[model samples]
Target: MSDSKAARARPIIVFDFDGVIADSHDVCAAACRWAAAELGHSDMPEKPFAELEAVTYEALAATISVDPERFAGLVCGALEARTTCAPIFFGVADIMMELSRDFDIAILSASDSDLINDFLITHGIWHLVKCVMGRDVPGSKTEKLLALKSAHDGKFVAMIGDGVSDVAAALHADVRAVGVAWGWQSARRLRASGADAIAMVPADLLDLIVVQELTEAPTR
Candidate 1:
């Protein structure tokens, strides 16, 4: 088979790191609060910090009045130390492994790829993922999705995330976006953000992918 045909046969599933794969809400919240304090900003509300799981570090930094790069460095530094503390969600590993059998799985997230790589490596499923595109990738999630769309021209690409930003990016990129209910933002928010579907649980995500595959298969 030609390389192009092989690529077409395997669609890509891009996952968000925090909330979706790793239960890193606490780590993110801590990092945001720490960054705010370090920047001498007393207006960082706990609510926005919790919502930080759903936003890019640049957006969060702008809200707190700090340089984006510096804010990311501070947060990433804080996250690096708590890497071992964030646990992978229940059944996520099994679901990822199951998806890897048919799809080329990758990660596209706001968190640093190196940080996420460490977590994936420690969890022993690093080999299952094809690539990691994080904040270091030099664009918003929308731009990154557009790049992936261009790279995988003929194949279907889906972004699985727990945030509105994820859904919006996928929509803008013309890719499918699946929002997980267990993540930071509410399902209503994801839907409002135009998510194609919402997975109520980890197993539900796998089921959604399988259903989509069957539905999209060419009729012979």
Candidate 2:
């Protein structure tokens, strides 16, 4: 392949849905509370999103005394709440549209696929995304990343998210992981999880992707 063609195909940016692109913290928390109450475990501490962000899904289920098997149902309920009124972060749609011009943009989220699709459609950015792999997509994030890497061949892959699981999945797949502080997890937690860099805002994330693409460009 020519250098230009290779460069055009080099970058594949995978984004996490909730917290990263969509501001659904309150919705998620409400869903969690509702799920806990429904499961007869409303006594769990009402922790802040930052603290809760550090906990794995299974751990969260255990923390709330909900059976792991029932966690998906809880998440589905959360999605229903989210779909009713989840707002995309400021500048997210614009940046995603800009980036999609030069990169393969995709979503690797724990959010339901239908919900993700609905959000994209609602925001009119559905066509900008090349793929959408939700939690029910038949594998873990690590497995999904691996599959994406394999499919993309020599493309340079980066995982951008607001959770520790995102960073861990990127590391496991041997790709770059960029954590956004404005998301669900704290910046401190993201850094500790081995994020290649932490983006404090949407513009910062855009700049990071631009810089990475340029740095990876082939020279004559």
TM-score of every model? 0.87, 0.87
Cα lDDT tens digits, model 2, 1-220, are 5666655564678898889999988777677777777788776554434665434455678666679658658757666664375899998888899888778888998777888899899888999999999867998889998887766664745788898888888887888888998888889999987888898989887678786553231221
Q: TM-score of model 1 relative to the true fold? A: 0.87
Worst 10 residues of 2 by lDDT: 211-220
Q: Which stretches of candidate 2 lie over 4 Å from their true place?
A: 1-10, 44-49, 52-56, 81-83, 214-220
Residue pairs with backbone overlap in model 1: none
Candidate 1 segments whose C-alpha is farther than 4 A from its true place = 1-9, 49-54, 83-85, 214-220
How many times do residue backbones clash in model 1?
Answer: 0
lDDT tens readout by residue for model 1, 20-46: 999877768777888878988767765
lDDT of 1 at 147: 71
lDDT, candidate 1, at 179: 92
Worst 10 residues of 1 by lDDT: 211-220
